[model samples]
Target: MYLIPGFLKPSTSFVPFSEKTRSMAARTNKDNKDASGKSDGRPGLGQLAEQHLEDMDACIQNSGLAPDTLAQLKLWQEQQEQTLKAWAKRPGREHTSDADRFGESLQDWERAKATFMAQAAEHPKEDSTARDFFSHSSAKRVNTDTVMAKSLKQQYPNLELVITPARTCNLIAYAQAGLASFETIGESSGKNPESLSWDLYVAPARRLDGAQGGIAERPFFEKYLYKWRGLEFIIYLVDGRDGSQNYPSVINYYILTPTKDKAQLLILEVGRWGADMHGEILVFDGGYWQKSGELFNSIMKASWDDVILEPTMKQAVIDDHLTFFTSRETYTRLKVPWKRGIIYHGPPGNGKTISIKATMHMLYNLKPAVPTLYVRSLSSFSGPEYSTQQIFAKAREFAPCYLVFEDLDSLVTDSVRSYFLNEVDGLKNNDGVFMVGSTNHLDRLDPGISKRPSRFDRKYYFPDPNLKERILYCRYWQSKLSDNKDIEFPNELCNAIAATTDDFSFAYIQEAFVAALLSIAQKSKKPGKSDEAGWTEDLGDGWVGILGGGDADGDLEKLVLWAEIKKQIAILREGMEEKQKVQM
Candidate 1:
């Protein structure tokens, strides 16, 4: 990116349009040289075109980072040159300095790359003093999914192409570590890098693993060259129109390798990009393995202590998972398959989800850090059968993993149930793949899957929390709100709330607590008060008045939280009874 003279940034100075118009008209003296300072006014569009091209050619000579073909390069120059020429003739040119405008528009790297990769398919066979050492290299644009890519391939009939969707696989990063050492020299948007400089724009994205996302520079149209192992390859990474109704941009990549299949081992080593993401888990969804830090973050927050179940049952659930992970040797000695499956069945929202998270967190902390491959569903572009196959394939590849099949009933339907069963039972030996499926309606599952000890070896029931467990859960919320001065949460209130929510599941209890607190925090404007900011944080609907009396045993009923809970519990109980009636 050599800064060509006058190749720069936007000028700070400005001449008003009215004064600019006068200056143009004021120069009516026949020899005033008009606005462009010539006998006849000219916008210098062609001159600017040639000047930008000159800078491009200069960059081509100096920058050694470019593909070894002129096919895309020539096409790029023609496209941007036409744009640069159009901008030069605009009526508002008088307000802008040529240096700043040229700096903004002129990009040299593309032309340099065009000359770099945009060279003769093969150098002269006789005169061979090509110092670059890549004199005879040829490149055919692969990744022929794009129209432009297909067009490039059409031009270079003799060119060889190894096309792949860049997002789907990571050849360069993979080869860098395993296949060959690699170097990324330079990158840019348009084909001619020496032309108008590219501007940067980005949107805020959530932090996935460690670093905050979407804040870094995103070159809309760019190219990267990887000198891997010993081979030189040109990669064109372009952001183009998605051709949809919304007209949003889509990124398409093209890698012009020295030879096809030369990097096969690299692809195999890398596998899928999301197959092994550090600080992330592989979640099979949308017909692909997506790396999910959101799920990982949820797992990080889950602790076994947070699960409100009987102590013995909780410990059994924990030990069951831990024993299975360590029992690979035991299974081998007994001639067992070394694989196990468990089912967690109960009404929704007791502790099924939290228990799974706690298990995932525990597994991740092991010595080797066993990765969890979560199966979201048997849904894929190919079909559910294909998705199920891929799911099991990934499971077998990364065995000793926690394969979670949440909502067992919906995921394994009649259409693909047989295929799923075959994969689970076949002699392929799902060794070290400890599967855990959770369902609220265990009766809906096939007897072949649910009853067979050979398939799902064990079953753990996550029933509704008992009164003692509910008290513990209530105290968990108490510890959270201890520091807040806005609410009062006493130790006895835990028992009172536990006694109040009799038939509620853990999920329903959580809703009761959440709803009660939200109601207390609700703000209201006093009637007949016109003040814009007049608002009071008060629980209405006669709750405070009705529950104002303290319970005979303690003053638990006097607390605002308890008052709100009394109202919420009444509402939840009525709804729960109605739901039960409907179900029956």
Candidate 2:
């Protein structure tokens, strides 16, 4: 006897068929039959007959019969199979593998074919009365509006309707898309290659009213479908939740199409919408326009307090400009253009870029929210005139917005100087638009663009930080490091560091602090390092005096052990000196 693999063997015990078991099975089979002689929602007589044939074949294989008898049985089985196959080949009947019975002869097939041919010959013309379901006629187009109306009538028979301003729609769309839960996907676009990113957020069906414990359900909008421009769109409004907030909503629009070409067209339309509504920055690259995803975290967090600028300069550039914009009616009453321009000119490594970020953050938090349009470059465009027109057109669309032109000298080259100036001061009224431009070299800009009135009217100089400002910057670092309980930074050390870094800019001071902290952290990790003595004799008299008396407890030298600070400060000073030499 052959044995089955242990893993493949069935788990349940098998009982051999006997007279009693056979009788029970017959009774169960009888109970399953209906009065109409059909299957009582179970396996029918055809399945039972097939199972019986399989059982008979198995019994015949196990039994050792005479050769003549076996041969006769095999011949009968082969003839039955051939007859079934031949019957299945006949036209007008669906052929299936499960088909077994056959009664029709070859003459029957010939007679049926002859009859079909005769009928076709008698009426050979196409029928004009019959409608073609697959016809490509324009009249077959489905009306999307009618479908939506009928669906609404059946789903929400008594729904109320409300009319409001178009501006209200913008607010609702913004709230649903901006404030809802979202995921971002980044991509690159244009021949010159610029980054483009968009957000996908769900739209909810139920909208919560301001009243206590009230929810306005929109059951009909759960999976709303509509047609636009001969293509079907299915919109899903789903219920969602934000952090620590309940009952937020998300709306998603999907194109309903089986063809790839139609699906791609729908995606292009959706992408255009995403570019318009969600983008925070507009960049012109490779003769085209692109939108950036969001402001960088570092830039978003920048503020006046973070930068090292004089209080008076901050008040003039940031505070006064914001105040002037709020006085729009005052400007109008005086009959002056409701526009302003400011330019920031300074050497590299100064506070120009950080100040711009701070101003952007300040303006974004205003009462009505002033959006900022950042232009990266205009070098790749066919002509600056067309590019400038497109830029101003978009700026006007988002009026009361801030237009930032970074490295203005590089963008408004000699070729595009006149075109750029015209766009800046042309007949087009740039009301409610505030422009800010920054450049390292003031001499590179054209006189008409930089020195002219009504265009970049105010110019601010960002000089390197003086000694007093340097001391404050050092103290700022000290305050930050005070939070770390393991580190001890004395006030005298900050003052000494400030005095030593006299010619350093704010950027250089920041670098020094970073280097010094890194040195301390590196030294802390090494093993077999015992508490060392304070400043040694090799540090020279100047270093010793700056650090104060050697034995004085809690002094600069005793707190950090001056050698570490001295090493990092020397390295930073050497690097700065080398940079200055290169510039010279």
Candidate 3:
């Protein structure tokens, strides 16, 4: 009677039985008994008669329904009749649109209420507790120890592993939820419970012991991944914008898994992944999340690209440098040698550094990934206990990395050059330790450094860029400048600059762009000032004028020419002077 849209009257209290209603109820009951075939009749008809009597008694006691109640019942009956009529006149038996049944957004809740009543009329959900037979409860916390043990077994299947359990004196003081697994140790007889070792990986949902522990005790997800394949590689998830914390400091740690059969090391990081040691260990970090998802996705796919060195450069150095790597004759000669080292020497800014980087990129293509060392200072190997041994020690830790010592002359002395020679020659048999050294002062290298046939067997000299190379360099920069149309990149201009800049290093060329930017700033003035534009009239003029137009005396012409020609000469002399002053 308390009606909203789609409201239905409660069947129990709707007892306004006229003569026809009473007759219909009797007939319906009789039909139900017949249809069910009550063979084991246990007062089925009697119960129906009793229920009818109770209904009559209740109606009599309530004085055949009060005027207000009769009015409410009448209204509900009329509403039901109208609803049935509307449903019968619909286009289809089922209402396709929710709007038709629910009337609108507000009536949707009423429709849901009506659904349960409609469903109860046909079929109903079981109310028994036993009906939910297949449900399992989830643990509230993760089980760290179990994860570690599982990782161990998966990494090393046959090795004997024992993990000391955390000490908990009050064993049964309290309890929350528990989970564990067992493994048979002695034999697979299936009946020997005593021979089985019960490995516990516990995650206490509620602290029954009232113990406080830090989250640091938990094993990281990396501890679980045992390098599955025979491949040895380290992957770095580099934050392209920042290098600090981009790589893991501790690069190697052994897993309990039996790894004797598989002995390569690997390192994998989220943003960038790289490996150092052959495959014994792996280190991965993930600090590149700040970048856009698209960029991060590209870095993830970067490992899949072929890392072969540019064929042109590879061909040029193959007879000299590449041969030391691929020569069957050399391999056969030092078939059992433990190490191999090569010296890459050339004029500074020529392309020695670029060649080494390209070679590393190539190695990345050939194999998974190798550890790379970018040596910038000779002091990287000079201290009290700062012996070359320390460098070798680190190299040994990352055993199979590409040990690159840039500017080798700084680290090795004529007196101590033998120490390096001995160290490298010692690793001849260990081809895994590939050593590549680069230096511009090749003539200054100790003769003993190159005395060993196997140590410095392959020497490649990188000369200054020729006209052809200069053209290539110019083309590269021009392509990069294509996105900015405001700047003029004339091929003739680049060729002119390249021709005028003799004995110039690639580094100086790169710096020229920076100088150009400085020139723009020096010339351009702030908008508006004393009387007008803040910019100088010469603003936006490239560095060409600054370097070319020297002075009024013609001394400037000679001076400008000298700046380009004597760039490297001045740099080396300046370095020598600084070194002498420091020693003094």
| Model 1 TM-score (2 dp) | 0.61
Tens digit of per-residue lDDT, candidate 1, span 96-188: 344345545644554554544433323311111111111111234322244545543543334455555445565555654465444333323
Give the alpha carbon lDDT tens digit for every residue of 168-265 in model 3: 11111111112111111111111111111234455554475775533422211111222234332111111111123533322213223234333222
Question: lDDT per model, in order?
Answer: 0.62, 0.53, 0.41
As a TM-score, model 2 comes out at 0.52
lDDT of residue 560 for candidate 1: 76
lDDT of model number 2: 0.53
lDDT of 2 at 567: 67
TM-score of each: 0.61, 0.52, 0.39
Candidate 2, residues 506-571: lDDT per residue as tens digits? 666665655555555557755422222221111111111011122222666656635566766688
**Cα-based lDDT at residue 422, candidate 2:** 77
